[model samples]
Target: MDSSNWAEHLKQDFSKIRLRMLEKLEEFSILRLNPKHFYSIKVEQESSLSPLAELASINLESARMLHIKPYVVSQKSLHEIEKAIKKAKPNVTINSKDNELICSIPEPTAEIREEKIKSSKQVVEEARIALRTKRQDLLKKFKNWYPSENELHSNKNSLEKEISRYLSEIESEWTNKEKEFRQLK
Candidate 1:
């Protein structure tokens, strides 16, 4: 393959890596009490489970509070919702008040923040591993092309630079996310 084609392939691969990294970072963010967290809950399918979002209307009563009111009020469904929330373990306080569930998200303590940081680090490490795997795959592809020694060496240098650049990008994202997590009350 020509240098141009190789470069294009690398760009595409790098783009995919970045996209996947972004998705992982989003998951890390969802570890907190955001509306997106509601979407993460999947109800059981014995015809007895339904997603919380679908069963009720969730509203942000305040910056640290959420109010969920089910459209069809039933004790069983409410209990199921409560059970689901507890099972998800979002570290929030759940209260059933006036036929609605009030979820209070507490400020993150030092220990909680530390846990989040550790989780974020794990996610970043996974991305780094993925990047390394992609780099190895690219190297193998280049080797199969039977390029000249000089060309191979030059491509290797370029590939290493790309890998370093991506690694740094992932690190930067983790650093920023860590800061945000720390700043969370």
Candidate 2:
């Protein structure tokens, strides 16, 4: 497969494995250090079956990384597993070791999105300020000489257009940043 396709596949596989590992690990409060490389399962001494190794088998080469040794499975599963292991223990090796099982979880932050939103708000605020300033300058220039209604409306419209140019520039900058942020993820 191509690089991007392979990366997507790996991402999907890791996501599923991480979910399952997290759920199972929560039972024992056994924090998985590198779940992507190691999985920890608790088994009771009484149980003949190997609960840890069973899950480990699904992800090959993961055994070498299990370092947290002598983890106890729940008392109930231990009893059942002991009976099952009588028929299965020989098939499962008894080794306790934790290794690098780094879990790769992708977490996206809202900071970038928030920044874009703030920029948009800033653009509007700036436009309002510019328009207000222009109106003040116009009033000063007319200096008590009342502008006719048509002349006043036309002047205000023209000033608004000038204000909009700055607003458009701010909007374009925000858009470019947003696009760049999306690509980073």
- Tens-place lDDT digits, model 1, residues 1-185: 45458767767776787787666666653335566677557655347666778878888766567788888887777787887887885577899988888987777678866886787678778888988998888789878664788878888899899889878987888788777777754
**Which stretches of candidate 2 lie above 4 Å from their native place?**
1-146
Model 1 residue runs over 4 Å out of place are: 1-31, 40-47, 60-64, 73-77, 97-99
Native-structure RMSD, model 2: 21.3
Each model's backbone clash number: 0, 17
Q: Report residue 153 deviation for candidate 1 (angstroms).
A: 3.3
What's model 2's TM-score?
0.27
> Largest lDDT belongs to which candidate?
1
Q: Per-residue alpha-carbon lDDT of model 2 for 33-133, expressed as tens digits?
A: 23332233344444343455542332333322222222343445434433333343232333322421222223334674455445544544554454455
RMSD per prediction, one decimal?
3.6, 21.3
* Model 1 accuracy (lDDT, Cα): 0.75
